[model samples]
Target chain A: MNTTTKAEKTEKFAEHLDQANIQGRGVSPLTKLDPNLTVREAYQVQLLTIQKQLEAGQKIVGKKIGLTSVAMQNLLGVDQPDYGHLLNGMVIENGEEISFHKVLQPKVEAEIAFVLKKDLAGPRVTEMDVLQATDYVLPALEIVDSRIADWNIKLQDTIADNASSGLYVLGGKPLSIDKLDLAQVGMVLYKNGEIMNTGVGAAALGHPATCVAWLANKLFEYGITLKAGEVILSGALSAAISGEPGDHFQARFAHLGEVNVRFSNKVDQ
Target chain B: MSTVNYQSTAEFLHRAETEKKDVFRITADYPDMTIDDAYKIQEKLVAIKLGQGHRVIGPKMGLTSQAKMKQMNVEEPIYGYIFDYMVVPEGGALSMQELIHPKVEAEIAFVLGKDIEGPGMTGAQVLAATEYVVPALEIIDSRYENFKFTLPDVIADNASSSRVVIGNRVTDPAGLELDLVGVTLSINGEIKDFGAGAAVVGHPANSIAMLANMLARKGEKLKAGDVILSGAVTGAVMLSVGDTVSAKLDGLGEVSFKVIE
Candidate 1:
């Protein structure tokens, strides 16, 4: 083991996992193969792989955060959140409909959106910095779909599955971040004029700013940087909803504006 | 002093959606099921129901409080979804036998004002996109043949979400301490559950953010105006037919419903 190269070790480990149908548990159950990488470090390996994939061909658009919700952190037995990579080709814009057939298991959620005015560098970012750096805010929708069969997955599995993310729809009007009273903003989720649920921005870690701050800090440790022109979806205003074709979903923000999405029976690019 | 009975589940939900009534009740045959197994089957049933035209609006977080999570034999809270057809009016009663496994919880649901999608987002970003907030009551009904599941099984089942009831929107966020907002859930005039907004992953909004970022990586992002049930602020309590459950939040309003045969 001491004589083996890193690439050799990875290859052997990958083979062993396939042969045994096992994961992790080599040095620790937190990661597989590399004994030196912590669970966090192992995640970095995957991230680097994604980076390389991007370097090779895929376009890097943004990143995703997870476990920010205290419920999920507790459920996964962690205190903070986790994250994964995103590609430019992945996001679906406003008015774009989603097909039920393309997703394995799909769910929907509503969230706040931020378009950065400047680069969000790590190791020194603050909530105020977020405010200063942010250019516009908008209401957004998320479609969560997992490729894993039966949605049977563990934390690592989900991490590998890109946090079970799928498609996204941006709605409503985009407002300057300065013009909005983000903390006090109200939201109403409706399907066909009927209110399904309602909530406020304070529910998101007191403010969506906190969620952004956490992400900036989280990435600093991973050697990742939050660049300008990146779109960030800060958690759900609440739990996600499930929808099928022909259903119209909308989120109405008190001052910022509102966004609406329609689901189609067939997946439309 | 007046009791109203709905003939069908669809009718009950319609009335609840219209805000014409605020009270709803349901009766279930099983009084002592764990809700895990019941939830797994509920997922399949929900898919079928959604396919049949009953839209799944969103999910509710159940057993999100630290105390409630401890009681549930896990460190984290559970989740469940709400459908357009499952809305039950407050103060009204629903049939218990119609459900596989049913439980009641107090939750705060956030209605989105904008469409959101992300690969990397934070709490502040969320607040900026928000419009208003509302108090809600979520009914978790497991569709599993029996309430039995491992931790992951429950997660996949969307935490046994059954239905949701959202009160009017509150326009002020600065006036409320979403994390520590105290709530008291009573059944038939007896307190059955009690907790605060803080119990939901420190704050309900933080939970919503977590879901959003997770979606981003998967090529999916949260849309604006989407209603998100952050998670339950308190624990879930056992409900029987003819039982009335109500939750009172300090600043946010109160939400209540009844269970009947």
Candidate 2:
């Protein structure tokens, strides 16, 4: 019989998400699976899933923040945000074709991926601290996939499912942080060669740096420090764009150049 | 910035475009018409044209030169699309009957080697990905009366885009003094106007980079194999029936087309 203990419940949810990801599919919403789950409990499940990936030999290349944009915050009806770990396997090469079977109902979002030059710990991380610790920023196209079926996820459900992250493609151009007004940078997302979405840096929690500062502070509560050279995806600049097999996506940022990616028509052989 | 409904205005613009006739500027009717409204109309007009089996070849810039911008009393340049049907073959004839009052502008076109997007798109990126720089000519024909319209009106008219004649000479832009490249406009074997490449938004490549950035704001980006009309090097010269129009660039050679009555 399945026990209702906190540890058992967290383990079960973690195993469920891990299996769903391994099978390239999604399951019922975690909140639906266990209506009593709390935000803190959800974070425990997330950490457990990360542990599983780490055990499978995938290194933690970076971290990601979700629901930072007001548009996204409104979409999920949440006033707060979530975080997740990004495994090395989740890094997609720029302009590479992504296998159809590797994702489950994926939606792409444009972002500014920050590469840190110094360790950043929370408790008092400010925007200035984030700027000073950053090496540079790269244009990024992040594929956010939901393990919660139909994307029917509450904040807790997504938090437990690793913030719905799947894969990310980073652009080649590395723009210096000091050269930009993060709040004024604009972005456009193309799907299958057609324009589909547009946004500005201010869309991501008023500024991309603000999100980075928030991430550092949030992680401090859990005793984690963002290490030097680690990539931090600062959340979506625009709304998530859903696409299908054979569709090509390009996210171009003003002065940031462009990043290209394609979803292949065939599943992995 | 007014997101006021523009479906009906778009339909009217579509009808005017199909008939190849002049209509009052959209701002003539709605004096408060904004650039956003013009872009909405352009978007709707493109949709209508696409539905009619006409394909968009690529994007083109307008008023890219500071001189033209000042002459037109505008602060910034505008852009429009080049429909596949607008591409006039080399040595082909541009029909006067098919278009309204058409004027030809000498231009340098960039053929992109890779897809480029914007926000932070730079001139360096534009130059790096440019596969070829070819001399070209644009035959701009506005649906607005006497070819006179406000900025918003011209944008709604697809930046007064009509036809284009691309030259055969494809030269690598590297090592060439692009800003110093001299271009001359000849009408019926006589020089009409002349300017250097710098006249095109300080540099012809800058125009393309600007176009990429401008389009990026609307969720669009230039892709590989797309030919971009950078902008005019000199003033747009009025065309006449049976007239031979040619533009020669220093290193890129010449592109010429005949106008038929």
lDDT of 1 by residue, B19-47 (tens): 32322222232223234433434455455
Candidate 1 has a TM-score of 0.48
| Model 2: pairs clashing at backbone N, Cα or C within 3 Å | A253-B118, A253-B119, A253-B120, A254-B118, A254-B119, A254-B120, A255-B119, A255-B120, A255-B121, A256-B120
A1-269: candidate 1 lDDT, tens digit per residue: 35456455444433432221232121222233233544553464456546555766888676666555555655767766666666765677777766655454566777788888788977778899988888788888777765445455456645644566667777767688765556546565667655555555644665678888888987898777888988887766655677767778877665556677777766543
Give lDDT tens digits, candidate 2, residues A1-269: 34467778888988887777677777888888778888988999999889877887989989999998666787878886678999899999999999988898999998999999999999889999999999999999999998877888888999998899989999958889776677646566778865554555656776788888998999988889999999999988767889799999997666677899999988665
Q: After superposition, how far is residue A2 of candidate 2 from its true place, in Å?
A: 15
Model 2: DockQ against the native?
Answer: 0.02
Question: Candidate 1: where is the Cα deviation over 4 Å?
Answer: A1-38, A52-56, A191-196, A243-248, A267-269, B1-261
User: What's model 1's overall lDDT?
Assistant: 0.62
After superposition, which runs of candidate 2 have C-alpha atoms over 4 Å from their true positions?
A1-4, B1-261
